[model samples]
Target: MLMAKLMNLVSKMPINPLIGAAGVSAVPMAARVANKVGLESNPHNFLLMHAMGPNVAGVIGSAVAAGVMIKYLG
Candidate 1:
């Protein structure tokens, strides 16, 4: 429980945008590589990409996890 609280607090700490920007910058190159590997040419490929986007599971999982953490924290 202490570990979870510590991690939850740590996750909320503002990270340098350079770190995030660097991560965002790699997605396109990764997609291009996926294209070369024949992973991005299909319509379903976009679905997978969107799954990685803000609309799908990634951010949602964080939001839900944070919500749970906050609820219990308070």
Candidate 2:
């Protein structure tokens, strides 16, 4: 959430900062939440697709992180 807000402030993009929250361990749920929040803010702001990118990235990132952790700690 903080990173999202910071990016929004720094980039000045029209993108909803809520999308950033989608980049979490709970991939699909986070994207859904972002979409829900965006819809609540504005009916026209459909952010599901936008949020998916981060959501997918989060999943991949988690996998990679887990691999690294296992490699070093397991």
| TM, every model | 0.31, 0.83
lDDT of 2 by residue, 7-53 (tens): 76878565567877888878689999999998999999899999999
On TM-score, the candidate that comes out on top is: 2
lDDT of model 2 at position 29: 91
By summed lDDT, the worst window of 10 consecutive residues in model 2 runs over 7-16
Candidate lDDT values, in order: 0.43, 0.85
Error of 2 at 57 (Å): 0.6
Query: Model 2, stretches more than 4 Å misplaced?
Result: none
Tell me the RMSD of model 2 versus the true structure. Answer: 1.7
What value does the lDDT take at residue 68 in candidate 2?
Answer: 100
In model 2, pairs of residues that clash are none
Give the Cα-based TM-score of candidate 2 against the true structure: 0.83
